[model samples]
Every structure is written in structure tokens, then in C-alpha cells.
Target chain A: MSAKKTEYGEDQDLLMKKSDRRTFLKGCSVAAAAASAALTSGCIPSVAAENSEEMKLRWQEFFKKNYRLMTQEEKDATVARLERLAKLRDGLDVQMGSYPPLKGVLYGYGFNITRCEGFMECVAACVKENNLDRKTNTQYIRIFEMEPGKLDPGTGDGQYYHKVPVENKFYMGTQCFHCENAPCTKACPTKATWREPDGIVVVDYDWCIGCRYCQAACPYYGRRFNWGKPEIPRQEINLRQHYLGNRVRPKGKMEKCTFCIQRTRKGRLPACVEACPTGARVFGNLLDPDSEIRYVLKHKKVFRMKEELGTDPKFWYFID
Target chain B: MQLFLTGLILLVGITTLFWGRARASESSFLDEVKKSTARFDNRSVPLVKEVTEDTVLSHEKYQGGSFRVLARKKNIERYQCSNCHNDKPVTVNRGAELTHGDIVLNHGSAERGLVCIDCHSPEQRDYLEDKKGRKIDFDHSYDLCGQCHFRQKRDWIGGAHGKRVVNWAGDRVVYNCTTCHDPHSPRFEKRFPATYSVPLD
Candidate 1:
């Protein structure tokens, strides 16, 4: 063979180098061949439920079953049960985020219109964990699942989520839509409320200068500027914290979802993301072309909470 | 015999030339990708002397409005470690993972630096860039964070922590390090007191 042809032959041999290690880089031809063989031999994971009626019935029963309020013990048991369901659904194992010794911890709420049983453990979770001034312990996200039957209801037909867990309901959770162009960041006089590169909007307690620019700028009312140092017992203090994202946030500073940066920023997922059982919430980098969040936007017919206003939120919505 | 020896030396020299590129190809390939992404050949990842050199993350703690004190206290250019380690984990070669999640000392597991961006982002949690300045790249932390923690983001969904609705199924999608953690303080996870010792919680 000519010198160039010989080099090409060597390259082909290198490409064909196969020991048991081929699984790592099977290459397009090999992977396609394997896939084709598997499909021909009926080895592919099935797309349709083997028994659609059974699946539908089970789904119906799941919808009908009452997800009522639970005590600490009950919630713990419930968490275990949900963990089991998650493994069965996706074959992935996960543990939920828990609070300090108190039966309850950090307070925040979210409503999934499709899956929400509506007892609002989330609402209650926020109240107890956040020690919300009972009048306003309502800091968590609340999404109402709604439907317009008049439109085509398969997927892209819904406008907003309202009162989730209703039949044929899909839920959405929105909180502190921490925009890259956060109006809150703009309105801050003392430059207190600012966007973390990680994408969370935060308020520096000592540095805030108590300006409510963040609260006013937030359209979702997601930003909560602390009017006073929240009065919780020192004993109730959850001291394990990060400076900006966690720690006992002092009063007169604003606070919203840090995307659970204290936890989620770490390897762990956010409290609300972990708390969810139905597999609804999705988070990832907007910049990364291959990230899961990118894939969601790429494949699914997703809609930003508000597209016309031009806030360009990273948060998204869709129907299942 | 002399001619044979000369031939042998040429063969060995050529073999070693190819061998260096072969052995070092994976890292160089990743480095090439990183540079292409940033449109930068790195210039060089600077190394500064601060908390010894074993740890990869520089604890340039942010305060007030700017990275003034942090910049003044630490001589990053003098010891910019990234000069050598372009893309791979430092612990594997240059610096070690902060098994304790801390740069200087051991506090616990979750708090240490398992990844690079645990402490180096474009904008820090405090929203302050490095003292030298903030104009060098795409969200500083965004690119660096994912360079290490490829698995943690598999779970965050919506405004919550784990995926609930959007896209939690199909193939799992993990995002970058900055998507979650601040690089200044590399926390692996909340101190999973239960996972390790009994809970003080």
C-alpha cells in the first residue's frame, strides 16, 4: 500500500481496537449495528406500556388516592414510600433533604397541579420550617393547575397551572424567578439584592441597607425583604449554613430561593426538588448545550413563565 | 554494527515522540476542547501561593462590594496553579480534593472541594468577581463548575431541589458546577450529618 493508504489502514485498525472496553467508545457504526440487532431481536426497552389499560388504571388510582396531611412519623414513612416509587419509575436512587432535629425544617411551598393532592404539605412545610410570621408563612412557591378543554389537550394546549392534582392536571412551581436581568437587582439602591453567578438572587443582611428594591422589582413577589429579624427561638436555629445562601438569615435582608445553593449547589438537590415525588421539576445550566435543562428545552415544547415581558427566565413550564 | 545502532536510536526517538502524544492525548484533547470553548488557549491557569498548594480551589473570599481584600491578601499570579493544570482535576495530579470540603483544614466531607469551581466562578455568590477583575470569560464559574461536578445536578428541578415536572426522565442531565455551588467555598453537600455521624440536626 502507498504511505497514505498504509496510515489510513492503521487508523482503521485503531478504530477497530476492541476488547471488553468497546462499551466506552463503540463508535457510530458499532453502536448502530448493536442497536439494530437489539431492535430486530426485540430487546429494546418498550415505548408503550405492556398493558396500557393497567397503566391507565394505576395512574387513575394514583390520582384518586388521597395524599393527606402527615405528621413527622407519617411524613418519614411517606418519604420512604416515595423513594421506592422513584426507583421503580426511573431506576435511580435518591434520598430526600431533611431538616435539623425539628420534625420540620426550612419552610417553602410549591403546588403541582397534576400530582398535588392539595393537603399542601409544602405550604405547611414552609410555615413550620420558615417560621413564617403565620400571617405570611407563605414564602414557598404555589402553582395552580388549570386547563382549557376547549383547546387541544394532549400537550401544548394549556395556558397556566392552577389547583394541581385535578384530573388531567399538570403542575408548575414558580418562585423567585431569579432572572439574569432581575428587576430586583436593578431597583436596589444600596446594591444589596444581587444575582449570584450561580443564578440565585440574594440579599446581604448586614449590607442590604434595608432597601426593598428587590421586593418591588420582583413580579412573582418571590423576593421577601425581611421587615425584622425573624423571631425564632435560638434553640430552633438551624446553624449549619452557608454565608449568602444559607445560615440563619438575619432580619431586614431579603431572601428567596437560592436554588437551594447551600444544598443543591453542593451535590445534593434542592429541598423542593427532592421533596417532589412526581418527577416534575427540572434544573440545569442554560449555557451548557448538552445539559439536561438544555435537553428539556431542546426536546419538549416548553414555555417560559412569561415570554412576552422579555425577562428571559431560565425557569420553564410544560404539560405531561 | 554502528549503522544498526544508529537505526535503533532513530526508531526509539520516533517511538517516544509518538508515545508522548499518545500517552498525553486524553488530557491534551480535553484541553483543546476547553480552549476552543473559551476561544482561549488558557494563556495559562495562574497559580498563587495561599493555602499551601495541595488544594485546587483558591479561597479568595469575597466581601463588601469588591474582591479588594481577597485580591490584596492573595498573590494569585505568583502562584496561579492553573498554569499547569488546564482542565483535569488537580487532586489527581496537581492538587488534591478537599476530602473535608475545606481548603485550609478538615471540617467534614461535604464541605471540601470535590470539584474546581467549588470556589472559582465568574461571579461569586456574593456577586463579586476576582480582585484582578471580572472581564476574562463566560460566567467565570459557569464553565469551571461543570468541569468537575458532573453528577450532582442530575436532580435539581424547577424552583425546587429535585426534578418534579420539566425533564427528570429519559437520560439523566447533569449541569455545571456553578449551576449549584459557589466556588469560593467548596461544599460537596449539606453536612449530611446522618450520612456520616449521627445527626446534630
Candidate 2:
């Protein structure tokens, strides 16, 4: 057969190789289909809810393959099912993006150490944009307030209540750095977490086994596990989502910052950077020599949180 | 040995010229980037709200290196100073109740304080006056700011000191100085964070 192209520019020959594995996975799928058919046709006794649209969508979601191995058709089908499921369950018409990484773009972030005033604006923006669990107050970004005379963050306080920018204190913000040599991605037993071509570290929620191995491996405390089902207010749910990024995740899965993949993939600034009133946060294509991140690297005296660990974090901190 | 030395000199001269030419095309480089990233107009993706009241740096002073800045006039509460300060002779009334009482005029150091007329033109209230007595438009207030804060101006020009709006790519539009900092009171005020972190035990 003539070779056809896929989103990643992979040919049909490569897809055939992936389908070979799909055949092996079909054993589990066949069983699920059998059970689903019995439940739908009343051959097997089940509650009324079992035959509902949400239940059917869950069955389809259960048998889905890893996001990486899915073909273009499969990806589209998965996104469609999720969209339909959101409508069925929450009565919310949500759009889920399965966009591939943009060509010739490597995202990087710049945080101005001097400019940050311990304002948790980035954290608030992240929580809303990512639709984070409000029950546990899950926040991906942390702004640490540090004392003067030392640059050490170990003694810094991530939790400070009172008026901010207290006399001699400085603020430093931290999140998933999307490191080049990420230990968290390496420690994922199921390969559920991996870095995209554009340098965003993404977690496939369905594929993740809730191992928590990645959490232990991360030196930056970047990964967060959902101990219980995420409870988001119906009104506050961000309708825009990305499959690998901020799509509503089930309990027992791992999630972290994907640099707002839903927004950045569309060439928009990450929500944190957008919400920053001080102009302290900078986000841009690292490969573009003329990008603001590049200019910051060239002109400012910048440093990462921990260089000894050799994570090669794309996130940087700079002071005037 | 003589041929090698001549070749070395020629190579150095050629390299210098190429470097100079590349340095001169900084603005053109941004134009090219904007054109190449034009394919980002994906219909499936909703377009980000575009800013319209934006102005570019002048080619005469900025050497053709233009970047987008939000227009200040639109945000200004009381614009067209000419509306009130119309072509009338200036009246110095320290005794009369102040027209602009809200203005604190706390810019500059305690000893070297700035009055309204220092930056604002008494002769032409609508326009700002630079150190050289040049009339500067409110839209291009960066020029007026660059007169004193040249370092910050240089950084802003290089995309370091300011915030970019809308998209990180294509047609770079940045917030001008007055957008973030009040020209009269430039320092940012300390305020409470949006949310608090988990309290430490």
C-alpha cells in the first residue's frame, strides 16, 4: 500500500509497526467489547446507569491505547469521545486539543527574580487555566518568599500569609521546568510521562499507572498526584483543554504544569506570564535567537533553581 | 608565509563586514520571523484578541528598529490636555486652589523633585517635552522615558524589561513604560498575593 502521512510526519510504514502492537492490545479490547455488548443488549443484567452514554464512553476510554501509539484516526476518536463524555456527564461542551508540537519551536521560560513581589497571580492563573482540583487547592506554581543576604531557596518559605514584599524579602516562583534531562520522565515505569518535541513534559493520564515513582524521582517537587477524584466547580471548568496537558484527569493519576499546552500550542503566552502585572515572566521560543527568552539569557545574569542535579531545566531565574 | 598572511587579512576584513551587515538587520530579522510564523493563523484555533491602539518606534531615532507599544492616550483618563490648557497665557497661581490636586508630584529624589512642567509642556499641554525640548507624542512615550532611563529603554527595546501582549510569536506587541508604571509614581505598591500557599507547621 502507498504510504500516508501522520501528524508527526511519520509514514504509514511506521504506523503499521505501531498497529502490530495494537493487535496484541486487541485481546483486552475484545473482552471489553464483549462485556459492553452484553450490558447494552441486556444479555447480562445491569443497572440503568450502566447502559448510559457516560458508561459507554468510559468503556471506550478504558480500552484506549497509549496516546503516543494512537493513530490520527484513533486520536480523533478519543478526543471526540471525551468531548461527548463531558457533555453527557457535566452538560458542558468542552473542546479538547490533540495538537502536535509546532515545527522549529522549543519553549522556554524566564522569571525575573527582582521583579517578583511574592504575588501568587501566576498560581491563581494556573489553577483556573488548568482546571486544577479546588478541593485540595491543587496549585502547580509556587512563589517562595526568601530572606535577604542569602540566595538559598531551601530555607525559603513557599507559604507566607500577610502583606507581600515584606521589607527585605524577595520572591522566586517555581513550577515544572520541562527539563531537557528530566528525571521524572525517566522514572515513569509505563512511559506515561514524556517530553514533547517543543520541550513540554506531558503526562498521558490514561496510560499512567499511579506509580508515584516519577514524583519521587523529581528533585524540584514538580509532580502532583491526585489522591482523590478532582472536584472542580461546574462554572470554573476551563472548557479549553489539551489531551496531554490540562484535560480533566481521573483520580490516581499524576499531573503537573505543561506550560499551558492548550494555550502555548496556539502560539499564545502561558497564563502565568499573561497574568503577571509586573512583566516579570517571559515565555518564548528558545530556538528563536531573537526571542525574549534568548535576549534575557544573553543580557541578564540568570540561574536555575538547582544546577547540581543536572536536570537541564528550561526554566530560568534572572535578576536585573 | 606571505600569501597566508594576505589571506588571513582578507578573511578578517570580510568577516567584519558580514558581522556589521548582520548587526544592521536586527529589525529586518523580526520582520522575517513575523512573516514565517504567519501560517499560525489556524482556523480551528480561536484567534487571540488583537490590540489595535499600538505604535512603533521611529526609524530616525531608533535606527529603523521598531517594536509595537500600546498607545498611552487611550488609557489616559483626561486626554487632550489642549481641551483645558487651550492657547492661553500660562497662569502661575500658587495661591489659588490647585486644578490637579490629586497629582502628588513625588517623582525624582526628595532634594531634586520634579514639577508638572518639568516633563509636561507648559506651552503645549497636549505634548510631552523631552530634555532637548522636543515634542513627544503620548503614543511614543518611551522616547520621553528613554531620555532619563536609557538603560531600561535599551532593555525594553531588546524585549527584556517589558511585558509582551496577546501572542508570544508574530507581530511582537509589548506594554510600554507607562502601561505598567505610573510616570508620576513609577514604583509598584506592595499588595496581597492572589492566593496563599499551604501554611507551614
Candidate 3:
């Protein structure tokens, strides 16, 4: 009995040593993260920063699994970590949505060329809704004021600085078309971006290597890369975020429109569609036979941009 | 005119597609017209032969009918016009100051010479009147607008034109034509865009 007791005591001591080594390694990582953050941001209080929750979160975040491969628990953990990080870094209580795509729902958008009137309300709304980088004034949607008889957007002026619906000039708004046969997803070496079940093309910002290969492969100029860290004002940041949508992205990641997935997956219209005053923007389930998008597809003389490329873009343009 | 021609062609196509069903329901369609005419009290507006209000109004089994035309009655600034425009004349008459001084009637072209009384009911100030002397409720202003813009009305009903409020899925509630365009001044004026891109040059 005494020998057994002595053996148990020895096991306890060994366990103690192992735990001590783990604590030391953890402390070292936290210190390293805290130091790097302090050097980069230069705002964190040094003494408390080493032991801060933020440093531990940053260290954990670096080792997170790819979003698609993560199990439900892992996804939830990452979301919680992200929310905590948002609070710790920016004092934001952001609710990051992780809504799965609804069954039998494939979204399609219809743009009325006759009604757009070159009003950039959609662009303005998108920027606000998506929490686009205000410093760079990053805009996802662009309303091109096309010259009369020149329907080609390549020749149109996207930056018309005067009163819109300029007499004869028609307007065309363009964004990420969320093509059925997306070349961007094929071009992604890291498999960072891919089309969702409900037809939104999304990027796992954490998985992206910032190669910009997807951007190059895109024929519609859909993707935008972060050259510097996205600087969004705290007050201006949209509190309602999605894991793959409008969540605050880190530096050196690619982002484009996800048809406001944070809202759309919850049965809401895209921000740009809601903001269009002239009712030019039409969005609905392409699968629904009675949907406005389907009616437009059947009745209207609809055309898709870059159809020759076999992109099979879901977005359609129609004139009155 | 070109729009009308396109609409006519499309209408022909629609008529052809639904020809059998439409033919079988001809008697019921006539009965529906008679019913609506009786309900209106006074009906002189010529109903479009191709389309009818019954098809648009009824939540028919053929069409997935979970949609509503947005009600405009609640939002109107000055409702119950009969309260002020009662039979009694105002004792204090402020000369040259019309009751609705802000109103500038410019609906049709200047040559068309459309006055307030042309659309606004002289008999009942609250209700709008079509060319057929039919009184239309403020909530159903689309009925009044449809007298001239039938093609647009058809498109709106079939979900081709106009805005659907909020949701893209589930029940659709569409805005009235007057919600976007001022009935008095129907044309959208030229305005500066809300935002612009940074010059890429």
C-alpha cells in the first residue's frame, strides 16, 4: 500500500511538471502576440496586454480551421471568438449571423436599364449595409451612365458628376453577378471563395492567401483586395454581421458583394434592391415560378453581360 | 407608342397561352364584370378585354396568390377630405390662398390641359375620378392610374414593374404607382446622384 501511494505521488509530480511546461509555452505565445500587436497597433497598454484576453484570442484565431471544413461546434466557437474580438478591439457588440441557406431558394436579380436613372442610392446603401471601408470609399455597386445608343457598359461613364438621367443617357448598375459557372471559385488555389447553396458567392477571409488570382480570373471585375487594413469607424460599422458576409475582414483578404447574405438568408431583400427608389432592382427566388424575377425572365427581353464567356450569370438586364 | 406595340404583342402571346382557360371561363368573366360594375355604383370605364380586375383581385388557385397591393390610406397627410369640403361654405375666406396652395397640377402635357377636376372628383373631393366618371378610393389609386396606364398596370400585376416591399421571399406587398411618382407631377425630375466613385484616372 505504501509503494502504491509513493507511485501515485510520483505520477502527480510528473503531471505538475507537464502542466508547468504547458503554462510556460502558453505565456510565451501570449507575450509574442501581445508584443506583435503592440508593435503594429501601438495602442494596447503593454503591461496588461500580455495577459489580456485579446492576445489569447488572436493566437487561437491564427490556428482556426477553414470555415467550410469546420464542424458546427467549431463554427460556433469561431463566431464566439470573432464576436469577443470585435468587443475587445472595437467595443462592438456585433451579432454575426451563421444562417444556412433556405431550401428550394436560388436568388436572381433583375435590373431595369430604363428605370435606374443613374441614381447611386443603391451604391450608398450597399456601402452602409456592408460596412465597406470608408477610408477607401469601397463601393460594390457601380451605376454606369451609358451614352444613348451605346448599351455596352465598357464604354459607359461610371463617374457621372452631374444630375442623373441626363436627357438621353441610360443607366446600368453592375456588381458581383454570382454566376452559376464562377471562374473565381475555379481560379482560387486555396479554395477560399466558392458559391453558396442559395447562389451567393462568398469568401472565407481566413482561408484566403491574398493571391488575387480570383480577381484576375473574374471577367466582371467583381473582387476587391485589401491593400491596407480596412478602417471603419465604430459608429458607422454595421452591427449585424455574417460570418461570410459583412463581418469585419482582416488585412490582405479579398471581398465582394454576397447579395447581402446576412439579410437575404433571413428572407430580406438585398440592401441595394431595397434602396432603389425607382423600383428598377428586382430580386426573388429564381426557383419560384410566380416570383417577379421569373416573370421578368419570361416576359422581358432580358440579356446577361459576358454571355459568350459561358459564366451563366444569374443577374439579368432588361429595358422598358 | 412603341411600348404599346410591344405590350400588344406580349398581350397577344399571353392570350394565346391562356386562350383555352380564358375561353372556358368567359361566362364567369362576364359575370365578374357585371358584379364589379354593379359594385362601383357608376361604371363607364371600358375594361380591357384581355385583362380583368377579377383575375388581379382574386387569390385564384392557379396563381400562387400570397400578395397584396400596399394600402395608401394610412400615409395620406390630409385624409377624410369631406370633413373640410362639406356642403357649408367657409365664413373666413382667405382670398387667393387656395386650400391646397401647394398643389401644382402638371400630370399630363400642357397641351393635354389636364385640370384638377379632370381626375379629382368635383362631386366628392376625397375620391379620384377616371375618364368614365367612376369614383376610385384613395387606397385603390392604381385603379384610377390604370385607366390610362393599363399596360403598366398589367406588368405590375404580373410582377414585372414596381417595387415589392422588404422581403424577396414569402408574401409580396407591392407599393402603389403614386408611392414612387407624384400623381400631380408624374415625371421623375433630374437630380444629383446620392454617391459617386473616386476618379480612377
Q: If the candidates were sorted by their DockQ against the true structure, best first, what order would they fall in?
A: 2, 3, 1
Better model by lDDT: candidate 1 vs candidate 2: 2
Worst 10 residues of 1 chain A by lDDT: A100-109
Q: Individual DockQ of the candidates?
A: 0.02, 0.26, 0.25
* Candidates 1 and 3, the one with greater lDDT: 3
Clashing pairs in 3: none
Candidate 2 lDDT tens digits, A1-320: 01111323452345457767777777777787777776666754455445566776777788787787787899999999999988887788999989888876778899998889877888999999998888888888888889876566667898887888888889888889988767997798877888777878899999899999999999988889888767888889899988988888988999999999988988788999989988889998876767788778879999887876667788989988
Best by TM-score: 2
Question: What does chain B score (TM) in every candidate?
Answer: 0.19, 0.66, 0.63
Off by over 4 Å in 3: A1-51, B1-63, B92-98, B199-201
Tens digits of per-residue lDDT for model 1, B16-63: 999975654333211321232221111121211122211122222211
Q: Is the docking of candidate 2 incorrect, acceptable, medium or high quality?
A: acceptable
RMSD to the true structure for each prediction, in A, is 30.8, 10.0, 16.9
Tens-digit per-residue lDDT, A213-243, candidate 1: 7677777656665566555554553433444
For residue A33, model 3's alpha carbon misses the true position, in angstroms, by 9.2
Q: Share of real interface contacts recovered by each model?
A: 0.03, 0.54, 0.63
C-alpha DockQ for predicted model 1: 0.02
Candidate 2 chain A lDDT trough over 10 residues, lowest sum: A1-10
lDDT of 2 by residue, B105-135 (tens): 7688999988887788879888999889999
Estimated TM-score for each candidate: 0.38, 0.83, 0.79
